[model samples]
Target: MTKEKESILDVKLFKRLFQYIKPYKGVFFGLLILVVLLAIFSSATPYITKYAIDESIETKISTDFLFYVVLMFVVLILQTVFQLLFIYYAAWLGQNLVMDVRVKLFNHLLRFKMKYYDNSSVGVLITRAVTDMERIADIFGQGLFMIVRDLLAMVVVFGVMIYINWRLSLIVFLMLPLLLYATRIFQKYMKRAFEEVRNEVSNLNSFVQERITGMKILQLFTRETIEYKKFKTINERHKKGWLKTVWYNSIFFPLADLVSSISIGLVAWYGGLNVVLDGAVSQGDLIAFIMFIPMLFRPLRQIADKFNTLQMGMVAANRVFKVIDTTSQIDDTGTYVAEGFKGDIKFDKVYFSYVDDEEVLKGISFEVNAGDTVAIVGATGAGKSTIINLLNRFYEIKDGVISVDGIDIKDVTLSSLRTQIAVVLQDVFLFADTILNNITLNHPEITEAQVQQAAKDIGIHDFIMSLPNGYHYNVKERGVMLSSGQRQLISFLRAYVTNPSILVLDEATSSVDSYSEQLIQNATDKITKGRTSIVIAHRLATIKKADKIIVMDSGDIVEQGTHEELLKKKDGYYKNLYEVQFLQEEVI
Candidate 1:
């Protein structure tokens, strides 16, 4: 939830964004040269007009006038060519820069610890990756380069105006201070407004995304009207944020135009007076002053608009850099690679907390020898799942060490450590892909034959073949095309095909029909044999065959033994839990 706080014109942020431009320096410099040419040619046209009027038309030289007109037409044609190149190259550079940034950002997100995602909104991240990136592209394509071209053109216009007649040029210069002041005020207010708009945009995206994803839940609870009202409130705020920008634009642009018009009128009135009375300012000079005033002042007005674009890009850049600069990723500095895990794991005095000063696992110590099936049975919130998450290195421990095969997990590479373990959760998630792809996860080393044999081994091969296309059948998003039991079966096949040394099933059989449970039970028996497995289940009946049972209560291990040994104890936690489940089963 933390955001980057920096100045509106933070030079450091600009330099960081500029690093992306380094890869395509050739295109960028070429674009710059094109912009320079555009500026020179654009400023030349008005001056050429001045010369044609004074030397050809005013002097009544028909042949000279024809030549100058043709020369002006050629200048316009060449300017058009440069403009085309500038626009094309600028857009190409912007698109390439954003593509690299989007890929890099996605890679960074992949390495982040689960803790970061637990606090961040998926909708906000989507906005950063999609919407905010578009704004960044504008910085290069339409913001900075265009502003530079306009400023350079304005400079050339001013230089020509002074060279023509200093007195008339002074008239135009007098209005600049006021225009600059207005522009400065406009930019200051606009920056604040832009930041508000971005924040609201993120909020709106988050609200809409969440509502759409959870539409079923909303309808189930009959809270559609309530959710609609909430969305309306967020949408209204987004509208107001945008309206502030509009309000500022409404006030600033007219003032700028009024100043532009006044400058032109002053130049005309003074230059006409001089031409009529003393002929100090010629008719040609007066006409060019009229042309030059807009050239000089127009960029000043356009600069304000372009600067707003630049400001929005910078705002987006700041948000993006915050994600890139985040240090919440798990440290992968360990050089050791766990080649063949023996599946022996030890958690020594481990303590962990998702939030500060609120420990979920308090000095919980346990061990699983190689090739042992250990069942961790506990009430909800007793940290049964937390242990599985820690074993996979999904969250870092605050205290103590977790070791696999006598090597501390933190000292082994994450990929090497995780590859050796496979987990089947109560909630199974499969990508929108074919059944074969879901099982193999597109792993290059896992072949179709291996997946098929694994499916047959797990006893789901017939169930899959009964589907529309067997292994090739596409399961839509989150495997919604399949039933809950079918999804769970797919997960089992996925875990089995991995051939992992350690298997963890966290409430994997808790949410299925009796028939599916039987299939899962059969699959479980095939997969867990001679492999180190940890089963966390609410149904005590399924875990009775485990080699060892560890009973937990309120983050502490309360009992540890095999099923028979624990049941033998009078008023034991395991005995009481077994009796409760036994009664529930009998009643059913």
Candidate 2:
């Protein structure tokens, strides 16, 4: 994957991320106030100690020292309370913001055109939605507010030190420029390193996800060792990406520590000399100045760490926004709605291509009247399935029109268009859910009674009852608990339960047992009884009962007629294909 250069601090992206916090502004602003109070109380403790040493301890006044000690305790108690409040509120705000972001990202993904999934990696999208979102939460939970609190403490500490003795303060301030310069250099390198790390993480996710999903294929082909080597190579790259960040931290953090130690040493040496030579700085003031050195430098060091969190959030936000900003969604501006379509589908001189300059359908035209069962047959890559894709508007046709019930499909709302049409593909997908939930898909309107009746009508009700749990049986991931043929039966029932006006079966019965094929054929007959049905099939013998058969080859329809009508033409393309493809099936 090519890396894109991203700014360490993207103001616009941060502004967008902050918009999610706007709804919870009460909590956000409350956290801000608590952070400031925490800083003030923490800074006050050092001054209290200084006062105790100089006024109480030096004079040996017991009452005065006791009063100072009590005041210091009050300050510490308030700081602890504020710190707890800050932690709680920050966590609440971050979790709420991430929840909102994740929902929006998921909803946005639902709107993307099917073409986007065709080209994008499911694993990378999962990373953006899941892992990247967590990093963004860290920006709010641990990053921004902590930076604010630390910086405020540092400023307050510096002000107190200057007030105690300006000479010592100036000596300490001299080390600031060198530390700031080192921080800037560290930020630059860490930003690039983090970007690479995120990219490698995404690459690794994509690789592992594909490998796991295709493990059966790899092992069947005896490619386990080969794939293992490839995985190690990718894993090594991911490790190297992370080590770059570690290498930067190792060098920069110790250098920061060295500078901080030098600053403390300078303060101690200068303040002690002033106390002895001129009696200008008291022992308590010298002690406080030494304590203030850590307060100043520690914040600077922590700001570097918090800034890393901030930068990572910005990177994650940029990736998330890229997906949300994509315009590759089906246009749903058409306002047309009908109570129900009559299911008269017309493809008039339609042209389509999945890729540019490569036409899959060349001026294909056909019509299926309401209640007709038309089957499309062709060899692979003949654009047979592409027809089904266009009818559902999963893709946009390049030219011409596809209409249903005398209304151009493009002029109707997507929801209205799709709700009336149901498709069952060759490869069925089932969620890791109960058989009933997989069929109903959580649609309240599709009740248990409706699903059972539909399954019974399709002759699969007994088959489902034969299972261990009947309709409640759990079909493990991708319906792995059931055979392919059983999965197809469930799909037919699912499609039937929708009571769609139009039904599409795209090679739905291929590669199933003979008994299962018989069941599927029975289910098909029931579902397509009164609906306008289009079937795309490779096994032409099964579609002999279709009212019309459309033969497609290389982006063109070579023949169209009833099965017997076409078989009468000895020299015809459909007849020739039937002899070569289905003559053996007829003999059997």
Candidate 3:
């Protein structure tokens, strides 16, 4: 993972993020008005204090003192109201903005081809969707608007200080160069540190997700200590990344404080001398200048912090935009809609590769007539499963035509093409959901009775009923609550319930027990009755009844015929495979 160099203040990324804010311009503008009003009221406070001291207290004018008090009170109340409004509106805008980005990111992910998931990390995507989005929201809710308010306050305060006495203002401005230099160094170091932190966070997420997902593998192989050591290494890297940010903060913030203190001390020393020796500055002016020093420096310090928030938000936006800007989605310019496909499928000189030039399927051609049952058998990496992938257009073939009912699959809308075909893959994936919901996949049109009937038809209804909640049973994550056999049975019920025009079972029953296999074979008979079916199987005997058997080896079809017909070919590939693979299975 080579890191891309990012600008500390990425203007382009911020511009893209602001597009999400466009929809809520009214609220955004309201926030801006509130920020300006808050700044005006805040800066007015010191001036009111100065006037009360000089005009009312010094002159012993009771009425003038009371009037100034009332005015100050009013400004405080308005400032409080503005602060409240700012907090509320900022939250609302940030939440809505995050919602828009999250929805768009998810929809973009849905458009990605299966190859994207194959190459991308699930945990990293999860971080982008969940964690990175929250960071982006902070830019709106806590970072940008606060920065505006602080900056406005500083500008007004500085103007007031200069109007009171130019010499003191110049003294205060002299310390700013030191602060600015320190901030520049801090920003450069922190930007690199923060980017590193984000990368490490993503790395940690990916590692933990995979480790947890494969915990069973680790434990079974007794590699827990090894994995723990690996986790520690990643965790330490994450810690180091964060500590770099901390180290810069430790250096920069104290430097900012030292400069702020020096500016204030200079103002006090100079203003006190003028008041005492020359009588040029009033007591009120001295007091007001001291108050304005903090007011001026506060925003500068806060701006540095807000700049951090802004920088992080830009980083997050860059990552999220990268995902949204990806052009890897399947081309869906196809306007053809497949309605009630006739179940005929054909592969014409197909060629494909998961990676460039490393073909997985090479000029492979086959056909299955409507109502025919075809079985594919091959050793691992022999392109048996790749055929299933190509048929469904999960990956596009570099050179080929896959047609359903004589229409190129690419010409038809993906939704319609996929809706008519159901695949029960070898590794069944079930959500952490109720059994019924998993079966119907929350399809509104699939009624409870239909699900019950489908389960009964598949001969697994009794086994399901044996559970505490039966169809309502929670399968937990990835159906971990159920046995592998039970999960497979549920997958079968899910596919059967869809009642697809074409069915594909890719090594579906390869790892199940005999009882599960019997139920699967029985369900297979019911499900494949009138549909175009393609079965990729390692257990050759299970597919012996298939109308046609295509034997594959190293991305080429070496044999094709009915089971008995292929058996009669003496030293044929199918016969050799059957003896070497199936006979060994029988012996086991």
TM-score of each: 0.96, 0.98, 0.97
Order by lDDT, highest first = 1, 2, 3
lDDT tens digits by residue: candidate 3, 4-79:
4645576667788889999999999999999989888877888999999999887787778988999999999888
Q: Which stretches of candidate 1 lie over 4 Å from their true place?
A: 1-8, 586-588
In model 3, the runs with Cα more than 4 Å from the true position are: 1-6, 584-588
lDDT tens string, model 1, 1-588? 223343447788888988999999999899889888988887788888888888888888877888888999999999988999898888889899988998999999999999999999999999999999999998988889999999999888888888999999888899999998998889888988999999999999999998898999999999999998999999999999999999999999999999999999998899989989999998889998888888888888898898899889989988998999999989888889988788888999999999999999999888999999999998888899999899989999999999999999998999988899999998899999999999999999999999989989989899999999999999999999998999989999999999999999975655678888888888888899889999996555556788999999988899999989998999999889888874577466
Native-to-model Cα distance after best TM-score fit, residue 498 in candidate 3, in Å? 1.1
Compared with the true structure, model 1 gives a TM-score of 0.96
Ranking by TM-score: 2, 3, 1
Please give the distance, in angstroms, between residue 434's alpha carbon in candidate 1 and its true position after superposition.
2.3
Top TM-score: which candidate number? 2
By the lDDT metric, which is better: model 1 or model 2? Answer: 1
In model 2, the worst 10-residue window by lDDT is: 1-10
Q: Highest lDDT among the candidates is held by which one?
A: 1
